[model samples]
Target chain A: MSVLGRVRARPQATAGVALTLPVAVFFVVFWLVPFLAAIYLSFTDYEMAGTPNWIGLANYERMFADPGFLNSAWITVVYTVCTVVPTIVLALLVAVPLSRPGRLNRWLRALVMIPAVMPLAATSMVWVIIYSDRGLANTLLGLVGIDPQSWLTSSDLAIWALVVMVVWKSMGLFVIILTAGLQALPGEVYEAAAIDGSGAVTTFTRITLPLLRRTLLFVLVISVAGSMQAFVPAFLLTGGGPADATQVLPYYIWANAFPYEHMGYAAAMGMVLLAAMVIVSALQFGFLKGGDE
Target chain B: MRAGTILRAVWLIVAVGFMLLPVYAMLVVASAPDDTDLRGLVFNGFHLPENIGLLFGEGNLPTYLRNSLILCVGTGVLDVIFSAAAGYAMAQLSFPGRRVLFALVIGTLALTPMVLVIPVFLIVKELGWVNTFQGMMVPGMISAFGVFLVRQFALGIPKELLMAARVDGAGEFRIFARIAAPLLKPALITLFLVHFLAQWDNLLWPLIVANEQELWPLPVGLANFQSEVGITYHLTTTAALVTAVPPFILMVALQRYYVAGLTFGGLKR
Candidate 1:
């Protein structure tokens, strides 16, 4: 009722308040209020008990000098760059071929999504086995005669292992997206290009790539956002690693908020994560420019 | 076949093989006998029932399953209703600040949900909702993506149909329920399924708030099974298969709709 009252109190929103009340409540409770609280929380020293003491900019200052915080920030950037670039490239590689119609292509289309559609937490567990000493990774490597490497335990490989898991699980959905983009390419344009004696690469670069820009931008932004928020794989597969190799920001932020009870620090990190996503996502808007379509 | 065709086939095979290899390992481990080597994907004999029993018995899987279902189904239903109602109102009904509300919806769709985690946790904790069902479910009940999906679809709905309902003396909410709703079925289904999967796949939120084991969702429970010390590979594999297999099978069963829903959901975000 109070939520309703406040929602109605908004200037010039009186009419149809009944209809918009739930949405307003959700906006206020979930988005508006929490968002503002996050701003305030980041400036304080709240540890889930006692009053929050204001210490403006201290949390943000501490992050630059804190090794663990810096490690997480650096790894998160590495994780995103490693993931989003490969995912888009790999998805394009698969999507272009799968765009055409065939029985096998149809099967492969759905096959790729099996990983994406499943729960990440559950699939991360499967990755745990895959990276295990005697698991499929080793089995396959033995066939190639490469000695087994401690994949998840090795600090160098732990983040890469999680990267592999994330790419495997997430790339397929992007494949589907890019495939849709490819298929939507005007067939006559491709025919015209081929008639002009254009090679496959030329046709792709000039025709297909230019036309797929919108969908590519869509995929790029979403993948960037998804990778920015990834926590489950790090949590499940590597437990943030033998060292801090895979302690991406979400996992590290959760550790601080819950285990260490550093609520204010986590809030500050969350703010930075949000700001980073906005900045990175804005850079991706560059994809939208210079496009005639 | 041309050389290009052969090359494409090889690429497809390698790519598809990469996707399915882990799933195959999961199946083999899940199917292996109880005493079979955990280190390998040895299939001595099928012991699926025994593993199922182990999960149900000692694994306390049912509780986790129920928790996930409660969170998933509840969030789905609430999401559909709220998004649909609001979408209809903002799209059709004359309301003050509709423009502002519309802007807010788009604003939320642009924001990453990770930043909301701390603030929402603080809110839930302040409400003493930690380890509670509402704590797990309520904050996630309405997504801007769902609202945006519904509003876009609802905008295409002929205003005459809704106006006719209003002319027949039906109330606003009633018109939405009876007329606007049936028209928005496809979008609503997409919204529901997408949010359902989101809730089910969610780990970070449930992990933060649902500290008690009883309230843990499958992802949380399943991750715990894998990450905890001294757990055998078989049990963890079984849990993994159990958590993963259903959604895949469900996706396969509803292959076209599932893909369409996911793509729509993904692209919209």
Candidate 2:
């Protein structure tokens, strides 16, 4: 029996298939099915109704002329760029110093991660109060000797207010990640650079950045993807706004999906967003794929 | 010391201040009396218990808390198992279609889950799972990121150890249950905590599927209260505190597991 079993595909192979089967089933039913369905649904007008009417490319075409969709597409782009840039930069700033080996840096690493752990819906309430007229915004402004701007209510500042809050929420995790990445770089190179009398900026730009490309690329992809899917803040804090200033694509898509019952339309927009994530991630890869071995 | 050592301490102190200011504000407002002066940052009274009682009383918060707990546990426990099992197989075993299965996991990574929300909802509804716990928990039980993280961690397990176990005539499932699973402790804990956090913060799917208040989790319930202007500042702050305090405690207690996630493979979020 042992010889016969050995002659066949390894007896342990069944265990592998059995072990992998659950996630595979989940991937198919939840991931693959929905993915294919999203693609198919984007092409049809299903609206939670009897039958999905096939109208090839119509929803995608309508997205262009639709002002709401257009505004949201633009807002999403703005939100992604604004949030991603500051998060990476600020996180890098905090990371560079905190990367040093010390008990303070170690403990501070967890301290910085606090906001990232807050429930977005819960934190949005706090921000609503902060951005309110008589709330912390005005009080803080009073201390700083600057007038309080209506943060969320003002169309001009609403998105930026949310951007600032999100940068706070996001920057910490990246700080920790970047800190680890910085710690992992070869130490001898820094020693060589120090011997050459290299300045801080010079060593960073010349030696550190190139070595840190993979981590930065990883961080960039994560930040970009996360920023694009940011819905809770806008949904809970701004309600897509005094105008549609804060109506990110996900917000707009949610609006269409539930409130307006534009399921097919939302799916189409979602597909576009998915494509945007893929493209942006690819671009980050390509752009950062410098002449490193 | 490095050139910026003193400067670095000052920088981090300010950043910590920024990081903690909201939590402090939450503590202050959460403990204050309802309809108190919102202009100043001071405690009106130590009414945190009273405010929390309000949530437990009329806010329907107990239900929300219970649902959130169940959702987090269900998803977290399942994600750890499914991910670890699948990851173990891919890393350690010789399977017929290992490459194909691994490719499937990779394929999931390329697609954004946000986009699939509609179709996933629709499918769940079709399965008669709308407004059900299973509906919310099942769709997200397995994360590709979780699978990849587990696989990365599992790859570090010595090949000879598994081979030795096999040579000793132990069944594959038994060896995995008794040996491999125990060895993957840090990865498992990390996966659990990460999924727990994600599930606790899950709002969007539950928002649509759980249209009824009875089924709403804290995130959805909190959003509902805020959106409709029904929830008070005290209750909002209290709920924020209530939601945040658990994770803060968890984080402080298990800082090692959280950091272990970063050290393991990559971002598990």
What TM-score would each prediction reach against the true structure? 0.93, 0.94
Give the interface RMSD of candidate 2: 1.9
DockQ of 2: 0.65
Q: After superposition, how far is residue A131 of candidate 2 from its true place, in Å?
A: 0.7
Residue A98 CA displacement from its true place in model 2, Å: 1.4
Please list all clashing residue pairs in model 1, or write none if there are none.
none
lDDT by residue (A100-145, candidate 1, tens digit) is: 8898898888778877787887788777777778778888788899
Assess candidate 2 and give its lDDT: 0.84
> What's the count of clashing pairs in each model shown?
0, 0
Model 2: per-residue Cα lDDT over B144-252, one tens digit each: 9899989988998998887787778888899899989999988899988887877788888898888788888889988876544457776677887888777777777
Candidate with top DockQ is 2
Q: List pairs with backbone clashes in candidate 2.
A: none
Which sections of candidate 1 miss by over 4 Å? A1-15, B35-42, B167-170, B226-231, B265-269
Tens digit of per-residue lDDT, candidate 2, span A1-293: 68855843476788989999988888999888889999998999979766789999999999999999999989998999999998898888888878878998878876777876777777887877777887877898999899978989899999999998898788777887888789888899999999999988999899988888778878888889888998899988889996999999999999998888788988999999998888888878788874565
